[model samples]
Target chain A: MELFTPELGLVFWMFVTFALLFLILAKFAWPVIIKMLEERADMIDKGVVYAQNAKEQLDNAKSEAASYIAEARKQQAEILREADKMKTQIIEEAKAAATVEAKKVMDAANLAIEQARKASEKQLRQEVSAFALGIAEKVVRENLASESAQTKLVDKLLNEVENKN
Target chain B: MALAALLLAMPAQAAVTEGEGEDFNPKEIIFHHLGDAYGWEVPFSHSQRIPLPVIVRDCQGSWHIFSSNRLNDGASYDGFYIAHGGEYSGKVVGEQDGVQYRPLDLSITKDVAALWIAALVVLLIGFSVTRWYKKHNMKAPRRWTASFEFLVEFMYMSVIRPTLGSKAKTYAPYLLTAFFFIFVMNLLGLVVIFPGGANLTGNVAVTLVLALCTFFITNLRGNKHYWKEIFWPDVPVWLKCPLPIMQAIEVFGVFTKPAALCVRLFANMMGGHMIVIVLTLLIFIFAKFGPAVTGGITVFSVLFSLFMLLLDTLVSFIQAFVFTMLSTLFISMAVCDPHEGHDEAEA
Candidate 1:
């Protein structure tokens, strides 16, 4: 029966001790611990979000860098092609100019040789005509030493002159 | 192992022989061990005990305070003594020939001292957790402090939060405090030593106070729906108006919740302690046969006691969990919106 009975003293003390314990803990301890727990959870969530943003930024930067490299490579190829075209053009122009210079030089040399040959032919023709005329004069002076022969030749010459006129 | 068992069983054996030269009465010894006292019985010696203060008022209405050592062995002091053979047996009584009256005993008995010790232990745990969080904000603490954090998180998240939802914050402190208080007391009762032997949780008076706290909190915090359900439940008009049968049952359920809480914890703890004491008393109970029988039974008794102590430790944790869970459920039922129940059923 005593086991079932609730003693007044024990009951009084239990209420006092337990009530004070609950009040003190609820006021001082629970709030701080629970707040910290919530704060930690919030921090973890924020950290995850921040990491996701950083990864996205990293991905963006990687793609941008790849595009820049590709553009740079394209520019390099364009410059190389232009340079090769310029090199071929310069080589072609040099060959053409060399051919033109050779032709001009050959034409000038042929003109000088033609002019010299013409002059030489004219001189030779003049010299040959002069020699023929000297031979004809010597033969006419020998034949006039005879009078009869001179009268006959003078008549024939007059007749031939009249006919020619 | 056997030597340790004997050492652990020594206190019960010593208590049985303290009355000296009388036949070994296991019932008296068991009850003495179960009951609260003014002095703490130390092991291996019953003539001397750690005396506590006895605060009493005599029949003359004068207050008296003295050390309980003066009342040893049925001794009397200043016309006040421990009554041994009456309705007031094992209580301090006034000097009278018959029908002596009991004084207003406000002494710090073994149970009260044990209560104080248990409260101190709980407070220490609370402060230690607070200190860890204060020192290193979000960082997890190590060792026992970490375990304490796990227990708090587990209880709040799994039990309290699921039951009470947003109101978990409001009631978590009381529930958590009750949990650690009951748990520490239950564990302390299992140890048969100076600081650990008082059966605080086994006392009906202590559990009554605990249940009362829960009772008051549940009723006071109950919302309109809760009261409506109790006074005018959602039932047929005939059941409520003609006999108030459904309403009566609803009202009965409200009181029974807390009553069940009180008795369940007290009886479970008391039974555990009683079994251990009875098993230890077997050595003396079987001594009349011979040394051989006594020796064999002693071994059996000690082994069973060791097993019970281990089981009680587990029971301590479980009962603490059960009490907190039930309290949370009750509070949630009172405060929860009726619409939520409908939504849950739909889902």
Candidate 2:
């Protein structure tokens, strides 16, 4: 028999089989395929959403961490600066106290030395005056014991008193 | 045999003699059997040939547009002639002709008519089940609906969705059309017996057109990334140097990819058809030799053809899937951003 000849017999039989098979497949097979497709689409969509959400959360976390680190560094710097200032102030106060204490010790030493020198000078002067008085009394007693020497002395003294008057 | 007798009776003088039963050559038999004295005819002259969508023919000196399988019964077969080139001298069919020549017509061709019927049946069943669900006012899907729903979900998750992503919904119609079209064509090949046994999927022209559609869509929707890859690919200096040569080669590669898509599908489908037909022909050849040979060859041919038909049916679905997947891959490449990674790094 020639192939591809258009015979109603072949055509009719083929049509019937085609219809039967198609109906069976549509009823039994196609739905299953379509349902599977829809489910797969949903799963993919969910995955995409999950990924996006994860990415956003990650970004937020990173920024938050960066900001927190910056703030901590700033606080650390401030603390260091305050500590430096306090150290300098303590050193300056210590130096000033040392200077004031040294000044007071020097003033006390000068006062004690001046008082000792003045007392010593006063003693020396008194001793010198006593000695001068003793010498003068001794001289006067020797002259008065000799009568001639006493008269000459009284005349000279009279003449000197008259001339002086 | 009846049909052969009818054809032989048509015109005795022009009739090509059939070889003697035992001496019959299979190739000669097939050639003579299918050969027409008048080759395909078109009405337009050489000057009038313009590449467009019309097939005009001049048959027996009558000028007419060669339309195949028109809706009208007798008029459907009247327009065109299919014959060997030496037997008849008419006009050669080409794209240059103002008319588009479709080699196969679904409405008129016997096997395609069967396929059309099958498609209708599939559509009807789907509608009926959906209607039943609506009538019941069920919140959940009924048995038939549920089965279909599950299949769709499975395909979406495993196949379509993964390849195309969330935007796959936008392409669902085309994907569905491709799947059903391939499935129906495969099924028809199994069931129908008519001219050339109607291997619709086997037709290279059909596959070429389908591949072309994918190619166009991929290119049309291309983003910066796709073009960048084509025009200025990020390759090593050794590969990228000699700008003109690499650029030319890369551009050619883009076109070749789609061409491969067309050729692969066409070759696979046509190869399967040819194998099945050749095997089936063995039965006739054996019958011509002797009855003893007939029985053995017939059994083998039938079994082998059946096995191949089942395989072909599966292959049809797989081919459609591969085609769609490649299409999605190409389009995704086109639409993806070139600088996305860099932007992410900066962020």
Q: What are the candidates' C-alpha RMSDs?
A: 5.7, 19.6
Q: Which stretches in model 2 have alpha-carbon errors above 4 Å?
A: A1-165, B1-25, B28-82, B87-151, B194-197, B337-347
Instruction: Give the least accurate 10-residue stretch of model 2 chain A, judged by summed lDDT.
Output: A1-10
Error of 1 at B18 (Å): 5.0
Which candidate wins on lDDT? 1
> Worst lDDT window (10 residues) for model 1 chain A?
A30-39
lDDT of 2 by residue, B1-347 (tens): 33223222321112122233345455643333222211111122111211212233342344344434231222234434332233222112222245424233222333334345546645654555456545654344557666645434545555555656545655544455455555556555444233223554555444555566667767887777778777778877667676556678878977987888877776677667656656666766565578878889877877776677668767876776677667666655666453542343244
lDDT of 1 by residue, B131-198 (tens): 99879867988899988777878887688777777777999999999998999999888878778788
lDDT of 1 at B111: 86
Q: Provide fnat values for all models in the order shown.
A: 0.72, 0.09
Give the Cα lDDT of each candidate.
0.84, 0.54
Model 1 regions more than 4 Å off: A97-165, B1-7, B10-12, B15-22, B59-61, B95-97, B288-299, B340-347
Compute the lDDT of residue B176 as modeled in candidate 2: 50
Predicted model with the maximum DockQ: 1
Worst 10 residues of 1 chain B by lDDT: B1-10
Chain A TM-score of each candidate structure, as shown: 0.69, 0.61
